[model samples]
Target: MSSQQQEKYEESELYRIRHSAAHIMAQAVMEMFEPGEAQIAIGPPIEDGFYYDFDLPRPLTPEDLVAIEKRMRQIIAGQHKFEKKAVSAEEAKAMFADQPYKIELIEGLETGGVDEYGEPLDEKPEISFYSHDAFTDLCRGPHVEHTGKINPSAIKLLHIAGAYWRGDEKRPMLQRIYGTAWKNKDELEAHLGRLEEAKKRDHRRLGKELDLFSVSPDVGSGLILWHPKGALVRHLAEEFCKDEHLANGYDFVYSPHIGRGQLWEKSGHLKWYQENMYSPLDIEGNEYYLKPMNCPFHIEIFKSRVRSYRDLPMRFAEWGTVYRYERSGVLHGLMRVRGFTQDDAHLFCREDQMPEEIDRVLDFCLHLLRGFGMNEFKAYLSTRDPQKSAGDTQRWDDATEALRAALDRVGLDYEVDEGGAAFYGPKIDLKMIDALGREWQLSTIQFDFNLPERFELIYIGEDGERRQPYMIHRALLGSMERFMGVLIEHYGGAFPLWLAPVQAIVIPIADRHIPYAEEVAARMEAAGLRVEVDARGDRMNAKIRDAQNQKIPFMLVVGDHEVENNVVAPRLRSEERLDALRVEDLIGRMQKDIEDRM
Candidate 1:
């Protein structure tokens, strides 16, 4: 097979194997626990693994995982044939009679194939079911021909946790079991290695170890309390972004945290995003809401004045804080949160300026990612879906074609997601791959035809007539909290010189060398470096170990020998290599690095 075909074949084979593994896992859980005690919901393949959500009588323990694995191995030995039979909606409903979630799914399939809790989709002609022996699921599936093709040893159940059905807190809470399956033992081992590496760099653990930030129980879930160290890092990140934006011709703008409900109605957010928003508060008999997005505020600023085409392609940026209600089950340490600041911007331009403006934004996005030492990226241009979105087909085609033209002009390759655009318009999303090969959505440039229409925003063209100007909503570092989480994992808590909370730690070789260490630290600080002197009376080895554990970028040892020479010993995070340098020379180098933001 050709390389492209080979990739497709491998993906197909892996999906079949992983999906089958999910079923076997569900069966294994059934065998271990009593019927009705453990109920299974949808189990599908994610990026690297499959997760099956279930509702069980008791929480699964580590011992339970061991027992469940044995049961899975026995089933794999049986090698039951997976018989996929297509059935009608009624038949599917009957087959899943005992499973309410499945029955709801069946009802949804019959009624335009929408999920139970989803907004309804337009009618489609055909929807079917797939069955594997006694376990029949309401899924539009393309499973493996049989379970015998799956390598049992390549599958391993990782952990168990809770997830809300359909990711809605109002829905039933279910147990989510995560597992990974690969085509061969070697691939499985590689995947396990990545997972282990990810665990080592998990931001939550690193946050505690480095004394950066915390999510205290008293502070509530999904909310971060940034300690001094974390705040310093965040402030530096914001300053860097601000400086870059200023240089790139972006005007800084700020808006209120709360806005009247009428503002959302004018922006159409009240119609589409009300569910994700907190309940409005009645302020003096008027409804007010915490701002869920900065687009409306930016639009208001644009509408504050009437302008000719001379002001075309105006860019306004804000580090605006927004609040959205997130389900507690999906609440992670900092990745998913209730409130966060977005590095948001809005670009207003004439129709003729779309292509160049998009190219400029793409270039800016690339630079921003590179500023954080990220280079590998995947770009996708998403167009509207006729069934889900509200827009004329002609407009969507024009917007999508415009985005494609922009990418082509910039010579940036991107995938086209045919039906993945927002209800308003098409968008180009950029996902950056971190050290662990995990992708994070760091930047997005989306066209907003709907918002301009809703807000009735217009500008006087060269023809002396008012015309609707195009709006682009862009967010680099989508959320400050989430981006910080990504940064922590990417750097393994060892940030580069520009981003480190404490760039250098001055350690005395012995108790008698404290004064010299303080002097060295003062000199570094005066040079605009974040420096700390370890005067804790700990042993040199212990201090070095602590610094290493915290992932400090540079450790400086000041001793009698070095003090007499007016020099300091430097150890970098890259290696165990050390060098002796004069204090002045070290300060100059450090200052240069900080200035370069390297």
Candidate 2:
């Protein structure tokens, strides 16, 4: 969300409704336990809905959720007026002394250092409590006038997940109940429908259904084992992008998986990024750590030799795999993995060529994503975080303005995320909006003046002086694993014709038609199509159904009539049957679609 939209959302009536709904839900849940059994933690209103954390007496279930939801509606119907009260530390402590979690939060509030969520506070806050009926919580008030203000029909209790207190894994585990609330039942239904569709399109479920990928526990969490079909789809996507890169003046480079500790220290990774990096490996009496980025190695290559103004603009690209340490709790299918390959590239250009290079890269990013039929996306310009950033004020400002200028020149609408940049520089992040309107961060064009200076990279200028070239780090597809995850969900496993693992499947009507099917498949394959021939003795309808389930683009049905006419009846996965056509004509039409990336 942009700053203006976020401000509007936070101040909107629906925001208050969700906030009050969370407190009401908390009241309903607190009633589930005895006087001092259930401990209440913090509850916050998030995008789309609200969630409340609780240290419950027992593990919750679906039945428990249903019961809690029922009680919530009752609480809402009670029409109790919400109230707030400011109290002293002693008074607050005495009110909920039995609740250990609330007491801890109260202590944080009393200290005037950290907020309720344990984040550092810029100034001391006036501690307050919000109460509706018998339950009250230590909170800053911005709730509805009364419980009756919330629509009962618009409210729902989603599900439960385990969350550590204050996001600290070592802290006590709490049950987080997620729920959504809208202005009306119609909106609620619409949201639920989208959620149902999302469930069906979930990458993990579809990945297994389509035999695309898997996360084997034996292979460790967050590690993807790409099956043949998934690997082929990735290969086709990468090959297409690689060809484009080569055509756009990018040269591929190879880098090792680990680097010396001193190299990382010099690059400032040891100081700013060591938390995400794995422990160093002891090799040849030197410390070598798994590379979490390919920038340093690419810089080393730049420093390998001297270059004049003629060689001022150099672009190095790589399908480099890097490793980072991710907690087991956050290890998602392919979306959030510990190890993945980045479609990484770095550009070293002199000051005079920087603006043109940025524009070209931005145009190329759009072209590449549009090839995958992803045209609905928003760009984000992340400025430097003062506390975390490494460069001087003037350098950071100039780099940020350059990226902003590029976005404006392209006429792409973008959001500026203040203090969200990487430690070393500013960046423009391209987030692709999927079919369901969820944004997936895919491409990034980062501007770094820090790395070139850190590595002491100098190129001879026209004035015969050693000058630091502007460096840009770019990744268009971010990572193969995550991009595949997004692509699988975006298309719902029915990829476009160009990127489909099996573009066409030839289904034989009977055992006698097997020879014709093989012949047709051979002809299509010879024309640069990924075709499969199903010669099983199964029924024709069964084969067609299987082909559709596999999400193939074309299902070529051949029998006596097609064999005699020397043609094929192409049935689309959409169930639309095209008229029978000669093998050459069918191949021509398919080739056109593939070329168009339809």
Between which residue pairs do clashes occur in model 1?
54-175
Model 2 stretches with alpha carbons more than 4 Å out: 1-17, 36-41, 55-63, 77-131, 136-154, 164-174, 182-190, 279-287, 433-440
Q: Candidates' lDDT values, in order?
A: 0.82, 0.90
What would the per-residue lDDT of candidate 1 be over residues 1-598, giving only the tens digit for each residue? 7776567643677887887778877877766667666667888877677878887888889888888777777777776777656677787777767778877766776775575445465764345655554565555556777666677778888888888998898988888888888888889899898878888888888889888999878978888999999999999988988999999989999999999999998887788899889999999999999999999999999999996898988898999999999988778777889989999999999878877787788888778878988766788999888777764567667768877887787677799988898888899988866545666787888988788888888999999999888889999888899889888887889888999998989989988888899888888788788899888978988998888887788899888899889899998767574679988898888888877877
- After the best TM-score superposition of candidate 2, give how far the Cα of residue 529 lies from its true spot, in angstroms: 1.1
Top candidate (lDDT):
2
**lDDT value, residue 321 of candidate 1:** 95
What TM-score does model 1 achieve against the real structure?
0.81
127: Cα error in model 1, Å: 14
